[model samples]
Target: MNMCFVTHKVRKGDGQGRVNYEVILEALRQGHYVYIIASELSDELAQHERVIWKKIAVEGWPTELLRNQIFAIRASLWLTILRNRIDLTIVNGFTAYVRSDINCIHFVHSAWLRSKYHPIVERKSLSSFYQYIYTRLNRSLERMAMKRTRTIVAVSEQVKHELKGDAHIEGNRIAVIRNGVDLEEFYPRHVDRRELHLSEQQLYAMFAGDLRSSRKNLDTVLKALVSVPEIHLLVLGNTKGSLYPQMAADLGLGERVQFLGYRTDMATWMSAADLFVFPSRYEPFALVLLEAMAVGLPVVASSNCGAVELLTNKAAIIINDPDDSDALADALLRCAADRRQLKQMGEEARRLACQHSWSAMAAQYLQLIQETALHKAVPLPES
Candidate 1:
């Protein structure tokens, strides 16, 4: 069988790219001839046996929207030139202009575009307008692309619903395939807080994301943490061009929060922490939540996160609203005051994270694509 994957990137570092990377590896492992049409691919994978990479480099483009458009054109040309050689074509949502067998959706632009917290809705600037156009254009293109594809694979139930309700695709059309974490890389390892910190007595909660945007909801976290003096927050993100550090100081949470800008050692920090707090206003599926859980750290996240659906029982604490600082404060205080319950929840989180390893997720994708090959998939609209 010849399998072709169409996406922008195929590397371990990126989120959506990692999914394609694992799946493609699985396809190769199964002895299938895999063709990757991507702008950027890991060198080792591209050099592997029976794997062909059609590099469609468009990184120099000024904006993401333009780059994607150029990539689609280049990828579409490649597909047309080698259509017969490919047995099945799997594409990420709106990646290429041509219709393919399976469409894997990472994020639903239509849903985010309509979100009250979207940049277009909350902000009024040229940059915000550009984002609106980018999202708006992608949303329209994705609808057409998803419609033409034989199958749709959503990264989460949250995205699945977005396709069904927002994109007007039927519920039966989308298959939920949550992203996987590298259990080996994320597993609990002892990290002595004394090595990086000034305090051994203070319980710490870690949050990681872009600090520049309120979309990640760091502002609300600062607001919530101002009251919880018992628990200190260590934020892992780039502080450059971000007001969060300043915001933390002004809010009188200077002692309560420590901003550790972006670093390669996330697993170490996560392992050292007592809790992982991510209350993003909108998250399709936060791999950080899963990664934190993988390291035996209890999670407190918002219900708006799609990944929250994967968690069951006491592994996570779900806050209904990200803006509710009182609730966030309470959740943090509860974990800070009770060591036994926190440990129990962290252990439970590890137990759940163990189930969603990268190998397991890749195997599921392999089996599904194999099944899809045997039977001709009917497009949801026509079916």
Candidate 2:
């Protein structure tokens, strides 16, 4: 079968790109000619005899908003030329404006735009206004792309529900294929804390995300840490533009919070921590949460996180509202108060993570693609 993968980057490392990378590998293994249309792709895929690379150069675009628009337009134009030659086109959301066979819904901009936690809704700054426009633009394009696609591959149940509600698409048209983690790179490990610059004896929980944004809810985490004095937070992410470090000090959590700017060794940190805390206001699906669990760490997450949907009650402590400091603090305290229970939760988390390796996810994608290709395209009618 001739298959086309449309996404920004398809490489094995981290994030959504890694998802595409794995699926492409599976397609190649099954002897499929993979056509990749994107701004960037892994060298391995580019050099493959069976893979046809259509690289869309959008490096000159001044803003990310402009870059996305340009990529969509260029990729759409290329799709027209490849239309006759293609059997199945698996796209990532609205990366291209062309109609697709399998549209992988990663993050629904429409759902985020509707959330009160959205930066545009919470902040009145000029930057926030620009973000609002960017989101709105993607939401409109995503709706069109989703409705026109025959098979929608939602990365999580949260995204599937939002697609049905936001785009008014039929539930039967969507299939949920949760993202996977790299088990070998992030399973139970013993990394020396002294070498990592973390306290050797301190009982600390971990939090990682874009600290500059309120969406990650670092503010709430800091507030929650104020109450749970016994446990500290090892903050990961760039501190250049982030206010969380200052916010931590302002909240009198200076002693309890250690802002360790972004590091490459996330798996090590997750393994070292007692538990992982990530009460993000909104997330389509967080790979970090999965990686943490793969490292045998119990998670304290909010209901808004799509990854939480994949977890059992014994594997994580799920808080209802991310903004509620009390709830987040209580969840953290639960870990601090009982080490034995926390250890058990971590083991459960590890067991669950074992079921969601990158290989498993890629296999699911290939199965869906093969099954989807057997049927004729039947796009949903506009609501």
| Model 1 spans with C-alpha error above 4 angstroms | 377-383
**lDDT values for all models:** 0.89, 0.89
How well is each residue in 1-383 modelled by candidate 1, as lDDT tens digits?
99899999999878899999999998888899999999899987989989999999896799899999999999999999999899899999998888788899988999999999899888799989999999999999999898888879998989998899899987876888899999989998887788997477778999999888788999888888887888889999999999998899999988888899997899998988899999999999988899999999999999988889878758888899998999998988888888899999999999998989999999989888987888764443452
lDDT of 1 at 295: 97
**Local error of candidate 2 at 131, Å?**
1.1
Superposition TM-score, candidate 2 onto the true structure: 0.96
lDDT of 1: 0.89
Q: TM-score of model 1 relative to the true fold?
A: 0.97
lDDT of 1 at 316: 80
